[model samples]
Target chain A: DAGVTQSPTHLIKTRGQQVTLRCSPISGHKSVSWYQQVLGQGPQFIFQYYEKEERGRGNFPDRFSARQFPNYSSELNVNALLLGDSALYLCASSSPVYGGETEAFFGQGTRLTVV
Target chain B: EDKVVQSPLSLVVHEGDTVTLNCSYEVTNFRSLLWYKQEKKAPTFLFMLTSSGIEKKSGRLSSILDKKELFSILNITATQTGDSAVYLCAVNNAGNMLTFGGGTRLMVKP
Candidate 1:
């Protein structure tokens, strides 16, 4: 089985532009979450979708939005991108296991550089 | 707001040495704590600790969580160059979201 997969290993965008990053979760996983990781920092959660429903959201501005398709793939859209938006966008997927298991496996992430 | 802080933002050690990373968190209705090793873009899962005192070990890496103190420690013994990476600490709260710390960068020199 393949691990979580992300598209466009690297991306470059101009300030004020918009961009969309995509992710395909591992097979049989229903929960997909997105995160932003700046240089030298840990990833910050942005949004999570479980079973095609918005499950959780971080403190990111409304400019950032995401959705999960019926196939369990996810897309993260960022509008009016700023230089600060340049970071590695990560997508993690996990299954809601019984007995309290919640280890989210991550993808290689898309490197976004907004100039 | 939920927060996670990691100590010793970066460390350098010779091969065969040992290292310990620390993580402390403050959150609402904490559920579990996790550790990950990030070599480049992706962070691979290391351990997910929910209960206190019980240590999770794999190879030379082991981690233990203390619920009462709201902190956790990760120990890497007999470190090898392969262990060089950013170690990330994260926590899951009732919100069903994982909040991460800034991470500790480990460099094992040969």
Candidate 2:
């Protein structure tokens, strides 16, 4: 089975601009989460969607939001980007069953650079 | 707030050497701990350690979790150049959330 897949792969945006990153979860998976990994740091959680509902949210600000489509595909949006917003945006998917989420799989991530 | 910390922020070793990476977390309502290897982009899953004292091994890699002490360690034997990457330790807490540590950058010289 194919693993989690994310798109654009690369993104370049200007300060004050808005950007959207997309993710498609693995087949039969029901949960999708977003994370941001700054250079020289580990990934930090953003948001998680399961069954088209918001299940969890991290410490990110109001500028960050996400949604899960009917097919379980997810999209993360960041508004009014800042230079500090430049980082790798990752998408992880897990089946919601017991022990399923314990082993969430990650996508290659979208590299976002804000200038 | 949940926090995960990794020790020896970075390490350098030769191919034949073995290394141990440590992770300690202070998370509320802790559920599970996980390890991942990141080459350049997204991280790849390595192990999920839930039960205490039980060691999970794959190839030259092994990991054990200690729930009481709230720490875990990852061991890689016979390290190879291919093993050079950032090793991240993450914790899965309540609300189905995952929090990560700063990661240990490992560089193995062939």
- Each candidate's fnat, in order? 0.84, 0.82
Evaluate all candidate structures by whole-model CA lDDT and list the values in order.
0.94, 0.93
Please identify model 1 stretches exceeding 4 Å from their true place.
Answer: none
The TM-scores, chain A only, for the candidates as listed are 0.97, 0.96
Candidate 2 residues lying further than 4 Å off, grouped into runs, are A99-102
Q: Quote model 2's TM-score.
A: 0.97
- Classify candidate 2 by CAPRI docking class: medium
Q: How far does residue A67 in candidate 1 sit from its true spot (Å)?
A: 0.8
Model 2 over residues A69-103: C-alpha lDDT tens digits? 99999999999999999999999988766544547
Question: For residues B1-110, what per-residue lDDT tens digits would candidate 1 score against the true structure?
Answer: 89999998999999999999999999988999999999988999999899999999999999999999999999999999999999999999853479999999999999
The TM-score, computed over Cα atoms with residue i paired to residue i, of candidate 1 is 0.98
DockQ of each: 0.76, 0.75
